[model samples]
Target chain A: MAREKRRWVAYGLTVPSYLWLAVTVFLPLIVMLYFSFLSKMPFGTAEPVLTLKHYKSFLDRDFYHFLTWRSVKLGFHVTFFCLIIGFPAAYILARKVHGRWREAILLLIVLPFWSNTLIRIFAWTMVLRTNGLVDQMVHAIIPGAPSVGILYSYPAIVIGLVHSFIPYMILTCYISLQAIEDSMIEAGRVLGASSLSIFWRIILPLSLPGVVVGVVLIFVPVVGAFMEPRILGGRQSIMLGTVIEDQFTEVFNWPLGAALSFILLAIVMAIFAACYPLLRNRMKLT
Target chain B: MTRWIAYGRRIVGMMAGLAMLGATSVAVADEVRVLNWKGWGTDEAWAVAEFEKQTGTKVVHDYITSFPETFTKLRTNPGYYDIVVLNAAFVEKAAREGLIQAVDPAMVANSADLYPDMRDTPQLNFDGKVWGIAWVWGGTSVTYDTEVFKTPPTSLDVLWDPAHADRVCWRDNAEDSVRFAALALGQNPDQPEDLDAIREKLRALKPQVKAFWKSGDEWLKLVAAKECDLSIVWTNNTEAAAVQDNLPVSFIVAKQGAVAFRDGLAMPTNPPNAKGAYAFMNYLISKEFYAGWVKIGGAPVSANSKAVEELPDSSLTRQVLTQPDAIKRLNFKGPLSDEERQTYLDLWQETKAYFAE
Candidate 1:
């Protein structure tokens, strides 16, 4: 009787949170799915009919295919760059730095989160535009170098995205690295392991979970980002996210937009599913 | 455990009480909520304040950047807004969707003060019923750096000139870009006889464009920075670049004519405060408010003739408004049919793809 009462109490404790999630997340997702199969927005005066034409439109247009590929490629490039730059900085902070200075550095690394992201991206234009700060500085240094203004270029988009998301990578890696005891390194050294070997065999495999977490966190959102690319990439940018945005905002085609969104969600889920087994085995080994 | 449950119940009770209080206060207040674009000139705040004092009804403003946003907001949150200022192109669609209601001229006392052309404009009136009141209008003209061209270019051909390759910016909008291209080719932009030829022309002009700007501010920034020598921009933006930012730029109506756009004030269907909305709409057309709108907002002309006559001769309004030829050159084409709009969008997508490659 006591055990039965305890289970009831536990169920009561979780019911509110479960109900909140159902209302906010699951309900909208189900509605989007329903809308995706409709011929028109059911709310407006237009007659609504059940159809698969919205999904078929994606397959019919090569533009949508190209944009999806581009978005995926962009995600890979951003994730690769973030890992390349972030892992080293995180290592230094976790293993080399100590006490108050380490905390200060970590805080400084996280400072970008305090300000609005759109404002920061806009500020980059001032640095990268013609006759702006960077150009003037370059001219001052070389006395007449060709203008290096690269705002509205693909590189500028990547730079802005990296600046915005590198903190996530650094923070995730730092937590995992900090958990590694110094005694483990000493033990490896006593066993005649080289620094490279130690890293390859011990540290890296152990930190795979954190790296995977950071990759998922950064890659998923970057694939769906429209504003960063629009502001920085100009005419050069066209991603699945922006195309979806155009459908809803410019075309007023809600059914098609919802269909496209579900496709993107499916792609992201497939990627995660593909990576899951490898990540699980690695975690078990560690 | 019992104590924790008691605390939770108290919190829920307090939240319910707070929600009830909010509901009652909203019911008691006399407020007119307006959904409009941001930056309606310096005089708007002052005019709104004066209107509130005179009518004893609080005016609330919600700003959106695009027509689609206005439509989406109204569709999702019905009865939340009293009035909306949208483009004339959207007025028909909004009315057809039952998102907005017909305007009663009797309610708006200043309806007779509108200029003859604006008062009976087919864009605002559809199916023999007036759905919106014309508010502000402007034209898209060629804005070029004075330093680059000593004499202003007379024709739209300059945008496609080989000598100006990589020195021009075009607005990244489907309708405007397609229409401008059609006009440049001497075709009727309203109903282009040959869409394929227009598409080819746009594709050919891709090499000359430095960037496809999405916003007025972006266009101004590119011009001010000398990143592009010329661009097709709104007249008000050009005015702002020269007068406000002191950028070395000048605007001219090309020989191909300019695309004119007018935004209208319409009442949303089943507004929370319809009386207040009508009063505000009437005040917007009054001589005092129109005068302030022209001066503070840098509007080229007011729909009210009396407001235009009141402006000084040296003002931009006097120069643009007095020129009947400039007004004649304005192309005020109505909205495209759904099928036509889709075709234009497809062509625009293809153009963007070509440039991307």
Candidate 2:
């Protein structure tokens, strides 16, 4: 009887949060799914007919296919770069750094999260544009160096996204890496294991959970990013997110946009599903 | 635990009461909410202050970056905004869809001072009723770096010139891009008889484009940074770049003619504050307001004839405003049929895809 009362209390505490999610996230998604199946907007004089035409649009257009592939490729490139850059930084913060300086360094690593992301992206344009800071610096060193304007290019897009998302990776990895006891490394070293072996066998396996979590967190949002690419990549940017944005904003085709959103969500879910076994193993180890 | 729960319940009750009080206060307030593009509202802050002082109605400006956002916001929150400033081309659609109402001429005291061409334009009227009052107008023209070109580019064909390959920027808008391409090909941009030819022309110009800018700020940055030598941009952006940023750029109408657009104020259907809306609209077009608007807003011209005459002839704003020849050469793009719009969208998609490759 007492346990039943305690369970009810826990459920009551969670009910408000679950209810909020239902209204904000789940309800809109269900409505979007309904809209995706409709031929035209139900608003105004248009008679709503249930149809697969919006889905058919995806299949019929090769450009949509290309954009989907491009978005996925962007997700991979950003995730790869983040992991390569973030893991070492996180490891050093977790293992090497000590005392109050560790706290200061970690604070610095996650500081970008405290500021506005759009403003940060805009700042990059100032640094990367022709006659911008980078160009001026390069000219100062090499006097009459060729233009180093990298703004409005694909590289700029990747650089901006990586800068924005790297903190997520570092934070996650730092948490997991900090949990690794110093005695474990000492034990491996005493067992005649080389430093490389110690990292490969002990540190890597232990931090895989954080790495997986970071990849999932960064990859999902980057795949749906439109603003960064639009601002930084310029004409070179043509991700599925931007196309989906066009449908709703410029084209005024909500049904098509809804369909495209579902396709992107499905792709993201499939990726998570494919990586579930590996993620599960890492979770177990942690 | 019981005491803590009681405290939490009391806190929640008090919060709900506070929220209700806030809601009631807002409901009792006499305010007019005007929706417009960012930086496109009343030119002077003092003007809004003056309007509030004259009438007890507080004027609120809700700024958006694009026209589509205006439609989305108005549609989702009906009766939430009293007045909306939009392009003239969208007035008919907005009225037909009941997003906005027919303007009552009696409400606008400055209607008589409006330029005849702008005031009597069919674009602002539909079914013998005015839907929007013409507010500010500007031209879309080629803006190029003076350092790059010794002489100003005379034609829209400069966008396709090989010498400026990978150094040109165009707007990423479907309507404007396709229209400009059609003009470049010497075809009627408004009523393109052959979309294929226009598509081919746009596809050919793809190699020359460095970027398709989405915002005026982006265009300014691209030109200011020397990242782009040429761009199809609004006259005001060029003006701001030259006058404000000290960017060496010149705004010139191409020989083939540039696109001119007029934005106007209209009341939404069943506005919550009709009187406040009318008051704000009148103040927006008043003669006293135009001088500050021309100076601060960087608007090329005012639809009010009296406002145009008031400006000094030597001023850049006055020069841009009083150019009857430039106005005559401008091909004012109007609303497209749904079918034509779809075709353009499809062509634009194809062009973007081609360029992406």
Candidate 3:
């Protein structure tokens, strides 16, 4: 009877979360799919008349395909950059740093995030402005070498996204890295493995799980990033998120926005599906 | 044991006495709920105090930085605010959507004293029915550091000048860039058909900009720090930062007029206290109150020319603050058909890409 009561209590706890997911997540996506086929009202609301016209617009041979390809490229760039930087940083935090110092370093990683995300992006803009800190530093380092302000460029957007999200990647990878057993490395060395060989054979394989999580966590959002690209990236940095934002804010085309959102979701899911098989194989091999 | 029980009884009595004292304390007064944009509606606290001193109405003001967020709150829970400051575009949109109630302008005697220009703006009214009272009139203008540019570059072409590379800031939105570029290229910013040209113009300018600012504070800091040479900004924002923060900046009346906008006061359609909300809107438009609010907020009021004349040295007001001529030149953008808007957005994105390239 006590076991039955505990089971009932467990069910009760799970129900609210399930209900919340249904209301906030599943319901919205379902509604979005429904709306994606509807005509946009003059005042920017959705109408009852369903049509495939919006999807047909998306099939524009020139424009739609180009944006989709560009978006995937930008998303890949962000993910790759984050992984290259974040992995080393996470390793240092998880395997190298001592107790209190590690805690202190972790605090520093999260300190900037305490500010509003928008404000933090703007801070980078201030640093990267033409006469701003970065430009001044560049001028000081190489006199008359043509000052380079990084703001509003593709590099700036990539750098800003990396800076803002690298901490998340590091923290995520750190958890997985910390779970790694020290004896495993010693065992690899005992089997006549050098530092590089041990890292390649043992460490890299073990960390694949973390790498997968980090890539998905960072890549999914970076694909749809709006503010970072819009702020740091000049007109050239129009990513997928900016497109979605424009549809809703300026165009008032909910159906089109919904359709775009679904496309983004499908793209993300495809990436996840493609990655899942590889991750599972790697997990088993490791 | 008997002595201990007696002592415990006395302690319990004292604790009960303290609890009773806490419960009996005078009920704290409820605050009047208000919602509006940050800089503009903050004076409501002072107004509330003044109102309380005179007519004993307790006012509590809450500010929201986002238009959609505020509208969402109003739509979902109309009782959340006694008053809301709305953009004229959203005012009409909301009223048409039945998200807000029709306000009877007769109740607001001060609104009758408004400038003829404001009352007649088609965006501010629907079928001769007023939805909101004018609060502040401002718009996007070209602003720069006087020290850097020396003389203000008059034309929008300056934004696209390759020599100005990495020294420009824009609105950080494709649609805004498209609109500005279309206008710059002598294409109609409002017309959807002009999007392709706008995109072409933007592509040309993308290389010049260093950043696109999304917030007023970000724009202010960028200009103040001399990060970028120029930014397209709202007049009040540049004015407040320059005059108040002493930022080295000036708003320029570009050769081609800029985007002009009006923000106004409106009662939510189903406000919990409609009478109080109307009274608040009425009080906001009184010439004396309007002038005072504008002075502190550094926002241009839509009051009559005579009311503006009453302020001393207001000539040195924010560059666009008093520029009716600038307003005349502006091609105000209104709500567009969804398809047309989508096409414009596509053009905007295309333009942004061209600029970046």
Q: In model 1, where do residues sit more than 4 Å from their true spots?
A: A1-11, A276-285, B1-28, B41-43, B72-80, B96-98, B125-129, B315-322
For residues B114-177, write the lDDT of model 1, one tens digit per residue. 8878877887888989999877677787888888899988889999899999788888778888
lDDT by residue for model 3 over A195-262, one digit each (tens)?
99887778878888788888888888888888788777765567668777767665456678888878
Candidate 2 lDDT, A45-111, residue by residue in tens: 4455678988888899898888788888899999999999999999999999899999899889878
Residue B304 shift from truth in candidate 1, angstroms: 0.5
Off by over 4 Å in 3: A1-25, A41-46, A61-67, A92-116, A130-148, A250-252, B1-36, B41-53, B58-102, B120-135, B152-154, B161-165, B173-195, B267-270, B310-328, B332-339
Residue clash pairs of candidate 2: none
Best by DockQ: 2
Residues B14-60 of candidate 3: C-alpha lDDT, one tens digit per residue? 44455445533342244345676665643545666666676455665
Top candidate when judged by lDDT against the true structure: 2
Error of 3 at B86 (Å): 4.7
Please report, as a residue range, the 10-residue window in candidate 2 chain B with the lowest summed lDDT.
B3-12
**Which pairs clash in the backbone of model 3?**
A152-A234, A235-B352, A236-B356, B32-B60, B101-B269, B203-B354, B203-B355, B206-B355
The TM-score ranking, best first, is: 2, 1, 3
lDDT score of residue A219 within candidate 2: 98
